[model samples]
Target chain A: MPTIRDIARLAGVSVATVSRIINHSGKVRPETEKKVKQIIQETHYQPNQVARTLYQKRSKMIGIVVPNLNNTFYAQVIDGIQSVLQKNNYSALISFSTSSDGSKYLEAIDNFKNNNVDGIITSAFTPPANWNPTTPLVMYDSADIQDKIVRISSDNSKGGQESVKLIAKNVKKVLVQHWPLSLPTIRERVEAILKELNRQNIAYVLEEVSESDPYLAAQQALNKRNTFDAIITVNDPYAAEIIKEAKRRGVNIPKDFQLVGYDNNILCEYTDPTLSTIDQQPHLIGQTAATRLFKMMAGDTSTNNDIINVIPIKRNSTY
Target chain B: MPTIRDIARLAGVSVATVSRIINHSGKVRPETEKKVKQIIQETHYQPNQVARTLYQKRSKMIGIVVPNLNNTFYAQVIDGIQSVLQKNNYSALISFSTSSDGSKYLEAIDNFKNNNVDGIITSAFTPPANWNPTTPLVMYDSADIQDKIVRISSDNSKGGQESVKLIAKNVKKVLVQHWPLSLPTIRERVEAILKELNRQNIAYVLEEVSESDPYLAAQQALNKRNTFDAIITVNDPYAAEIIKEAKRRGVNIPKDFQLVGYDNNILCEYTDPTLSTIDQQPHLIGQTAATRLFKMMAGDTSTNNDIINVIPIKRNSTY
Candidate 1:
């Protein structure tokens, strides 16, 4: 119940000094800061965050909007974002955009604006045509937006190219499973794979599957009786589903067929035959996005052309 | 940049009426509410949330603290909590307590108090001996806290009992892998399993493993050369790891050894031979905690003794 004025009076410091110590906005001597903190703790004086936010015009909070948290990739990305945010003395308000149409994303953005978050980082959701945001927006992995917004993502095209190069010589025919090509990230991966496969004169089949249940799509693909010698999946979970279903049908991995997955999540290592995967290093991607957002907030206009590189991790999945 | 006074003038309403409409705290007629919204939209008026918070003395925000989000079970629980919180018109400020010592949890609680959250929901971190909280707190999946704090958890004991019942008739010896037994939830499950196994006079071994890397623990357990006919894991990921390792060692599941996992996560169905596990229904647990928090926030003092039931799911792992 103690006010800032009371704290200042008790600590024998100016109100601005107390505010500086509380907000960590301006530099203060270590001794003075320690003493002020001690007094504040002793008094149990809770500063009103609303008033502080109004005065500083910074909430010290960031909004993170992802399509789904149930997916380990997204969860790991969030974990990376939080790691950086916590170190920088910021908190994250996370929301899910379960639909591809981006309605939930719009709602999340509106909520961020309403709460006056200092910045926002979103993954895989494009803003509507009529939507214009006043807050600084950083798009993660969906880089096809307007030039004003900052985009940080891994090199999906390069990952796709590498995946094909690693397995192209070993297989006669390959099945490339992916999500909808409407998403720019997915499109880039598919395009790169096709370009590489065509250059090699290798026969391949491309299948677009629903993001929610790639297992069912894998099932349908198997039932089609395609004579593919290998499978390339857009992500690790899809690769896992394919592996499980193939095992159910008595298909021998690395002997009868080879498989590769993207995102290089934990599932890739835990699966039998130890799945070969493209490591996007999602934690690094998240950290990069947070650092970029902070730089943008500080009025740095330097263009960031950095794309986190991907590496192909070869395990027991392919010969 | 438009002020509330300007909004009131344009909407033909008093400043207090405009405030009421903005806060959604008081009743406003349908026509007046519609007109006020129109004017507000036309002006692009962004309310100062800090000022609004000061006036209302409520932030309409909740805090959720969990140990980790990379685990799918925690992610699912958070998804459920967000579902309920969003429906109730509240935003969640989520934080993680990475360490088992409970320091991060205390910090999160302090942050929640400083931010004036209406309530808090936390999982599996005990407060320090000297710590006291003034905010309404709900402990999720950790029920061994003080008597004053409301604890909401699934019947982990019953889950352990059911897991044993499902696999008891088929196996001669069992290996139970879990995290530290000091945790209330883990203790409950282990105790229930042991009690049931003793009642049935079935021999079993208990092993505590590092949670961060259950795969390594599974490897170590397999390397110990224990001649066990079945394995009971505290969660699904560990079960998956054991299955992967067992298969690597040419150990066939349900044929060589039966397995039962807890939490019945999506991984259970995706693994080869499909893991039989206990279903804790994490979504319902989250929903129940949120409902209880809301009841407590409304000054309800009645004790809640409801325990969500756990079900045993049969799959190829347990025959």
Candidate 2:
């Protein structure tokens, strides 16, 4: 309940000194800061964030739009964002917009704008054609938008190329399973893989899989007439299901068929053959996005879009 | 930049009617409401949330304190909470405080209070002794707190008892690997297991493992003794590691040693033998907590603390 004036009076310092200490803007003597802090703590003085936001037109809050929290990848990315946001004395308002219809995504954006967030970080949701937002928007993994919006993503194309190069060594025929290519990020990886395979003249079969029911997709892929000496999956979960189903059908990994997956999730290390995967470094992607958003908010216009490189982790799944 | 007065004047209504319609507080004529809404949309009217918060002393924001985001259980719970919060037009401010020392927990509490969150839902972190918060506090998976604090937890004791009873059916000598029982939830499970084991007169040995490194604990547990016919793990990740390590050592599960794990995560089905675990229903826990918090905020004093039921999932490891 104690205001800045009360803290100043109690600490025997000017109100300007109190404001400086609270905002860390203007310079104040170390002794004066210490005294003001002690008084503020003793009196349990909480700065009125509502009033401050009204006066400065800044909420010190950032909005994060994640597709799904059940995915460890997104959760870890959020963790990375929070780590940076906490250090900078900012709060993150998280909203889950899992629908690809763009309605929920637009609603979340509108809600953030209504709350007057300083910035927004969204993962893998393309805006509608008629939508336009004035807020500083940072897209994470949802690329190919307008040039004005800042985009941050892992180098999925490179990851795809490296995966093909790795699998091309031992197998003549490879099965590549992917989700819908409607997502620009997934399309980038798919195109890169196809280009590399064509350049290498490797024989490969591409199959589309449902992201929701990857296990069924794996089963359907296996039931197809074409036999593959090796398999590459869009993500770890699909690869895991393939490995399990393949084992059920008496096919051995590495000996009969090699396997590779993207998104080096923890399951990659625990799978039967210990999956080989491309590590996209989701945490790093999140941290980079937050850092770039902060820089942009701080009037650093030179902060350009970034693409984090992915690393190929080889385990027993592949030679 | 259109104010409430502008929208009201354009719609031929008073400012108070616009405010009531916006806040959904008081009754307004249907025709007037529709006209005001149309004009507000046309003019792109966004109410100043900061000003409204200052005036009404309510932000319609709830804070969630999670210890770790990498864990899928917590992520699923958060998803459930967000689903409800979004439906109610409330925002979730999430904070991660991984330390058990309680400093980060207290800091998150302080930050949430400063931001004027209507309530807080924390996952398994005990509040500092000297701390007293008047805001509605909900403890998720943390029981035995103050009388006023609402606690929402799965019936860990029941889950533990069921696990022990199941394992005792096939094996006499059992090994139980758990995290530090210092956590109230873990303690409940451990105590229940021990009590049941005693009642059945089944010999058992208990070992504490690091939650961060379950694989090492599994290896150490395996190295410590090689005679147990059954093993009970604290969670799925530890069970997955134990299964993988046991396979490495040429130990067959179910044929040689039965295994049971807690928190039936998604990885449970992907494990080689497929893990048998206690399903804590994290989604229901989250939903229940949010529902109770909303009720409490609505001045429902009779909202009692709840204990969600846990079910034992039968899988290859146990059967």
Candidate 3:
């Protein structure tokens, strides 16, 4: 590894100057730092991490608080953000708070802050509106924060509307599958879906089950046999369970009953009739979230903290 | 947070000795270090991270390399390990390498090494026979590295057998979705599956797809419209694609064909038939990998690095 001294010599600067530039130490002329950086890049010199940590006095880490890593949606988003962060040499401290309450989320965030994380990406429920961390913060799909913090999410309303419209076109009586409206985002989706069905004059049953909890959702859905012509799920996995149980009862999708799910997760494409699902462009959402976080950390204060919505992707589930 | 003085008083050590122990300085005796750690635990005194970094010159960061983060099998495994790492102060540098070639894998490993990462978690193709690292290492789904490293994986042979039996019961003609046996693990699975099928007096077609890509495998299978009755995919996502395409062509599952997938990924559940899939227990495997890495780092030199087989879980896709 080329030491700072080697780069300093190559750039005609003292080792002290090189260190100053690398650590963003006070008052090195911008032109001089640029020249040093040029030489460092050319030499493929990766600063010795051990020495840099000592000088920077900060862990170049982003504290990422996700609700459920087992959930496919959050998992994909984390993968996306991690991909970008890896390129920037920033490590992610990922914490999965599968707990229903916000206590673990708060603890994870507080702990990460104590660890001197450079920034934080967390769910909205974890931190109070008045809460402020030493580092930068961003929220993913949180409505409670409103316009207070950077928020990234897909168009849940549009997704719900589209799924409703799909069901309206194909089936007469449909059962909208869902978990309890635990999050405001899910509630918004449920509302939008109902509104769309009303607008279309499509007769539907609002089957409110604990769809997010896989075991309960499957068991509950199984208990209700032959009630509707189709079922629309809040998310893809829940849709999977409904379809499986429906099949066990000899219910045929798009034949005896149509099935549609939201979030065209990888699983959506694999279902027997290939579930028609409303898409949130999960990968793009990930890319957008990371880029937005980077921009905020880079001192973009004017960014509207209001929900930034991603467009829905229509797939086989609708048709 | 409590300062070193408080810890020193608690441990009956001098202020300077406490500093050395908490900062990971070599001058402090091991016994003193242990005492300091205990005090830290009892008090829950998370030191100023900035101060800790200044003295230790280490960030306690680790790196993880997965073949594809989008793949649920790997994603679940990552979730399991990340659950533990997040609790500790270790941040993870996550990366995905497309090629299974050891060079791409090595590139990621070297990145972690150069970053002064405390350890590594790699979903390796085939781990090196005597791979040793200055930092701790954990290998997932890799085998035959002697007792020098940690390895975690599902029983591919058993997964294969379970899949075949599941498919055979429903469909007389089954298609084994796979690529050429370049890897011994893949070869073992293929052989075990054929052996089981032969014993069952089943007539199966070995549909060898040249590409290991999921979409390609699905497309190739789709092209053979009536070539098979039941489709067994190499992985969950691959099985998903077959189901999607088969449905697009109006082929009803269980009516026209039976479908089974491996990796019992969330995709299996979301699929229309709720995918009869072989669950590889990725979560348990991931936890094991992290635990083993800790052991290896703590100077455990006698871990069995042979293939650690986890049982496959059966889900809805089968009969």
Candidate 4:
């Protein structure tokens, strides 16, 4: 609980002399420095970062905001960001908004600004037109909105095209199960899929489903029996549900119909008839965002966005 | 970019008066406060948390350390902690130590202390004998080490016993796939399982497996097929891998052998035939750890450890 004044009083020196010794600035006699160091050690006095930050004008902290961590995709992204932060000797003030709403994101941003963060990196959220951020900001998990900020987004159009190409040879009619197109990221993928299917002259039907109860959506997809020869699910978990429901109904995968999923998460390999999905390289997205944030923090002003490529994983689920 | 001094100069008031108005600490004339506030709004000035923390001695920050985020178990724990943090209006300084080694954990602790964290909550790791932490420290994912610190641990013994009782009716012999017993948590479960099996007079064979390449472990376990009627895996993902390998080998679950895993993660439901596992309530553990940490930070001196109950989930993997 001792302050720098206490250390100076105990060492029989001026507070300015003590500050010079502590910060390794200004000239101080060796004897005075030795005495002050001994007293500090005896008192177990730790230098206060708060006080140092006042003079330095840098906290060496970056504020990060993510929607949630329950999904491995986000977890991997954080891990990637953490690795870079570790190497650079930086700490992160993390806020999990637990929602995609712009209000929650705004609150987090306000909190970070109050903490004097040098920069911020957050998942995609639409900011109000009039609310301009003063801090350097970078975003990920976006659809490349290009609204005066740098964004690191996965190649969704390429992902959608690959999803179609993965099962193209085996399908005459396709069923695409997806969530709301209101989400910009999802809209990009769905649009790309439709465009690709049309170019291939393949017939397709779009089915909107709920992401929460994916099992119900899977069962409904299977209830359509021979209506479609293939199903492209929203993600791997949704596709896994379809596989489970198919097993319950005694229908064989790849024999009766083929299935493909997006976001090649851990479930892709664990699911029976292993899921063929798109790998968005979530880690790369995080690394790129953090790297860009550091550049901005160092006074870089370029706002050009970046894109990461996706990989198509050919597992047994698809022909 | 505007400092408090600049705001005071622009408003023609003393810096102390500006500070008082910003903190709402001292009474000032209504006109003076209004003039200062108008300048502040025009300048877009944010009060530096570091300066406020220096006077108040409260950072409104908690340092959190988790082993890794790649697993859903840890992510859920972090989510639980975030929920409580949001409610309390606090931010988390998170450090993800990619290893279970004490050295990595110690480094994180040092970093948190240097940043003046109010308290710390970390996953289990052994500290050096002479390393006495001055901060309020709480641990989760522990084995109830009774190390003179508060701990929130899952009831590993009960989880082990439940795993045994779930398949006791159908199994004459069991295959227990596990990792190193040097880990305190894993050792506790293995000991409890052995005691339960001894009480039931069921024969068993202990097989050590590499957690990283669980598919190979599953293949190895099935190579000794028909020797044991049931398999107790280290965790849910390992069990999922077994199911995948079993399908490839034409081995039926619950018909050829009953299987049970630990930590009822999301993968438990997605796996074919489903999976019976022990739910350690990771979120509750995190919430309890954080709640206990806040109490300690509030000057509570008690150092008692707490345990969270585990639930047994029955599915088609077990009879």
Candidate 5:
């Protein structure tokens, strides 16, 4: 096994230059980098990451916490994060919370701290009363209410307004299907929807639904089909279920009622009538969060919240 | 911060016992383990994982390389891997190989080796001529042809037979829609399908399609709707796209032609006529691969190829 010193001697470069090239930290000329990399490849010189971490006090690992992988949304977010991590030559230690609880987030953070990770990026979770920020942390899919923590959030207010505009054109009474409003992200969107509805003088009613069973939620939402002229679903999957259920119930989508959904999921384009939804660009959100975390890890102590804009996709489901 | 020695002293246990508890190695009484954990938590004793890795020559990390996260199949597999790792106190270092090239896989393996991962689990890829097995590796979604490497493969041969059976009941001519058959896994399934087709005296024509654009593939396949009585798609998403295209051309599924697909994806139920496909149970495959890797890491060097069974899902797309 060739050591870093051997690589430096072979390439006629200083050890610090080789270290910069290996860590992807400092700038190196393209020709020098290419020449050194070719030699490293030829020699098969493997860097001992464990010893390097011990000496530098940086693990070059980022801890990431996602809610779950079942939803393509989170998967896209992880993909985006990976895009950045790979570019920076950093590895990710990921934990799937699987449930909406703060305990798992805390445990993951503690584990990352024990590993001496460079930084942490996690999804939305309420911090405990005794919360302390000892490491650079970035939160996404959050409401951006923490006093000292940086956050990356989707522009839910704009999405909510877009949803109303999509359906309110030909709607009278609209039924809004939703999950728990205790979630600050959901509340932000719902509040924006209500304000827009009031501004447009559209009569609307909020219907709480079960997130676990979108099919059953669709059935319940459709049971009031005769009363409402339009329906706004919790998300794309729920909207897809509503379309399936409507087809079975002999209900025409845009004729009987209009429909709109959040999270422009991939299923949107495949549905029979094609769904109208909000494009949150979850991939961009993940990339932004990771980029910000790296900036903070580089000694930028500024705490701020960033918002990625949303786009409204109109399709056959809307009039 | 409290040290491990302090925790062991307070719990009236030896340093080795405390070390075993922290590393999740060896055996300890339930009460003693609980008492020690409680004290450690209360005292905020964070284990130094970097130092531990230096001393133990084990990182307690697993490197995972998947093709991509765009498909829900890979996501489900990662979820399953996480389930096993969470219980055993292991963290996953994941790299998403977005492209089909073998170079990304090689790079990932080199990085994982540099980081000293305890083991590795990767999707199908061709190894170089001078490949050496210096680390424990388990391959999934691959042909079990590697000499010393353990592989977990879905019973693709059985899946192919099931696909033939699903559409063979009332079919004369079949259009087999597929991507590049150069891939070993796809070739395995195609061989079985051809065998089953010959056994049933069914006439079949292989139609190569573009995986990057499924909608266009649907259009191309539908152009031959008059010549074939059934179409077997590469996967569920492609099947769903065929359904959408057929609806546009006023071709009723199971009427104009029967359809069967591979991978009973989430789109199966949401498709208009539903998709009759093969269930690969990717989650179970992931769990099995991780479990086998752990066994190998425990000094069980027996190499055996495991095949997880596939199921034929009966849905409305077939007669």
Candidate 6:
């Protein structure tokens, strides 16, 4: 509730002088600046962000665009971003772009612009063509969206190789199950696994499952129970379901077949025997993205193109 | 961008008449309301929510208190609630109270109140002392939070019993793996399983694992490989991790052991062999909570004390 007048009175200065000190707009003696700052600290004076934003045309806010909130994989990454942003006094406005129409993603960008947000962090959704955001942007996972100055991604290819290689080491043949085979994480990992399998003379199957129909995965797994000795899935949720269908048909994992999931999602730990999957360090990714955004805002121009690689967490399912 | 004056001019009425029509205020003639509504529709005049909120002292917003965004289980429930709330023209302000101390939950509540939100949809964050909310509240899954007008929860007992029964049918022996055995879901399910095992003369071993630590689960499962034939976790994440650990030990799942998970989290479909777990229908739970919150705000008392039951989702994890 402390106002500019209160701080000015405590600092033995005019309200205008206090404003000058806070905004660094005008000449202030070093001693006067110290006095005003001390008074502000003592009075616990926090400026009204809304009023300041309207005049300055910028709020220390960012938009985080996510494809799904129901996936813990994305949630973990959000938490990481929150950790870093919270420390730097930046507020994040979250939008889940689930419809796939891209309107929600476009709306998010528009909302941030109208709200005078300083930056944006996108994970899957693309921006609109009608309105090009001049704000600083940091993108995650996908490199499809253009105009973002900085990008951060987990080395999905390495993770895939690590995941499938562990399985091929034990089981002579492994089948990689995926839906929407066009997805980058799925396709790239499959490409890496297929190469490794061919090189090692290990049999591998690339089964494309439809993500739209929830029942298709179980039905497909049921149809191909014996064609493979191991199953490496795109993520933990699919991996868990595969385990379920395999069990109903009287298949034992890592015995009759081995299994591996990706994204070391929190679900991976709580799974029946525990799911061994790749750990992308989602929190780290978020933190890095936020940090990079801050640097850009502060006028740092160093470009980082190194694809961050998180190690695969080996667990009960991988052997 | 059409204003009340524009609508009034088109409808041949005063601006106040248009205001009455838009605000749903009293003493507006039916003819005026119809004419103004038509004009408003023709012009596609969207009311400025923030400006209206300042005048009406209503945010048209709802506070969603969650344990943490890290858990996809709760996120699924939140998504379900958000989907409904968004359709009803409400905005969801989310807060995560997964701190070591529970006091941050108080801050989120106060923040919502400060923003003048119309209602709150909260999940399991214990409120601070002497804090009473003037807004309508809908609390999810707190058996102990005492308030006659605000509570909704799944039938934890039934879910526990179903999870236990499914494990019993598939595996000769079952292991109750969970996070902080003190959690209501974990505790209730464990008690229910003990009772079921005693009644059926089924062999079982209940293991309490820290919800935060998976390394402990890995070590314990390795040491007791001979003891448990199945592991039933309180949530999908735990079940997924257990599945991973069992794999690393060279133990074949469902051949040597069966695994049952809870929350039937969307992630359940991704784990290798998929997870056979109890589906609590989290989306319905959230949707119900948001609907009730809106109704309560509108002074309706039609919603009942909900005790939804979990439906079993049979997958491959059990033979």
- By summed lDDT, the worst window of 10 consecutive residues in model 3 chain B runs over B306-315
Residue pairs in steric clash, candidate 2? none
RMSD of each candidate relative to the true structure: 2.9, 2.8, 5.6, 3.4, 4.1, 6.7
Model 2 residue B301 distance off true place after TM-score fit, in angstroms: 2.5
Ranking by DockQ: 2, 5, 4, 1, 3, 6
TM-score of 5: 0.91
Measured with C-alpha atoms, the lDDT of residue B206 in candidate 6 is 66
Off by over 4 Å in 5: A1-44, B1-43
Expressed as tens digits, the lDDT of each residue in A1-319 for candidate 2 is: 8898899999887877887788788788898889899999999888877666765688889999998888788987898888889889898888888787777888888888877899999976656565556887788876544466688978878988988976877678888888788878888899999899889888889988887998897788678625878888888988899888888998788788788998899899888989999998988989998999998888776536788889999999998
lDDT of 6 by residue, A1-319 (tens): 7877778887889987877776667799999999889878888786654544533555566777787886766888788888777677555666677775667766766555544557888875444555445777777875322343467867767876788766866677777777665565566667777877787888877778776653567568658777878887767777766666666677776677778888776666655556788888887887888888888778876555436776878776767
lDDT value, candidate 1, whole model: 0.82
Question: Candidate 4 has what TM-score?
Answer: 0.91
lDDT for residue A160 in candidate 2, whole number 0-100: 86
lDDT (C-alpha, whole model) for all candidates: 0.82, 0.84, 0.71, 0.89, 0.89, 0.71
Model 1's interface RMSD:
1.8
Name the lDDT value of residue B268 in candidate 5. Answer: 87
Which residue pairs in candidate 5 collide? none
- Per-residue lDDT of candidate 5, residues A1-319 (tens digit): 8999999999999998888888787899999999899989999988788778876778889999998887989988888888899899898888888778788789888888877789999998998986875888999998857578798999988988999999977689999988899989889999999999999999999988997999999999888899998998899999999999999999999899999988989889888789999999999998999999999999998887999999999999998
TM-score of chain B of each: 0.89, 0.91, 0.78, 0.91, 0.89, 0.84
Instruction: Give the CA lDDT, 0 to 100, for residue A212 in model 1.
Output: 79
Question: lDDT by residue for model 6 over B1-319, one digit each (tens)?
Answer: 6776777788898876776666777698887788777777788786654445544666556778887776666777788887887687665656666663557766666656644568988876556566566678888865433455477778777877777777677456766766665566556667777787778787877677766776677567657878878777667666666667767777776778888878776667766667899987888888888888888998975435676677988887886
Per-residue alpha-carbon lDDT of model 5 for B209-296, expressed as tens digits? 9979989999998887899999988999889999999999999999989999888888888888989999999899889989998998
Q: Choose the strongest candidate by DockQ.
A: 2
Per-residue lDDT of A1-319 in model 4, one digit per residue for the tens? Answer: 7888999999899988887887778999999999999999999887776676665666778899988888788888888888788889888899987777899999899988777787899999999985668999999999977778788999999999999998898589999998899999999999999999999989999999986888889888989968988899899989988988898888888788899998888988877778999999999898999999889888898888899999999999888
What local lDDT score does residue A79 receive in model 3, on the 0 to 100 scale? 72
Alpha-carbon runs more than 4 Å astray in model 4: A1-46, B1-45
TM-score of chain A of 4: 0.90
**Is model 5 an incorrect, acceptable, medium or high docking prediction?**
medium
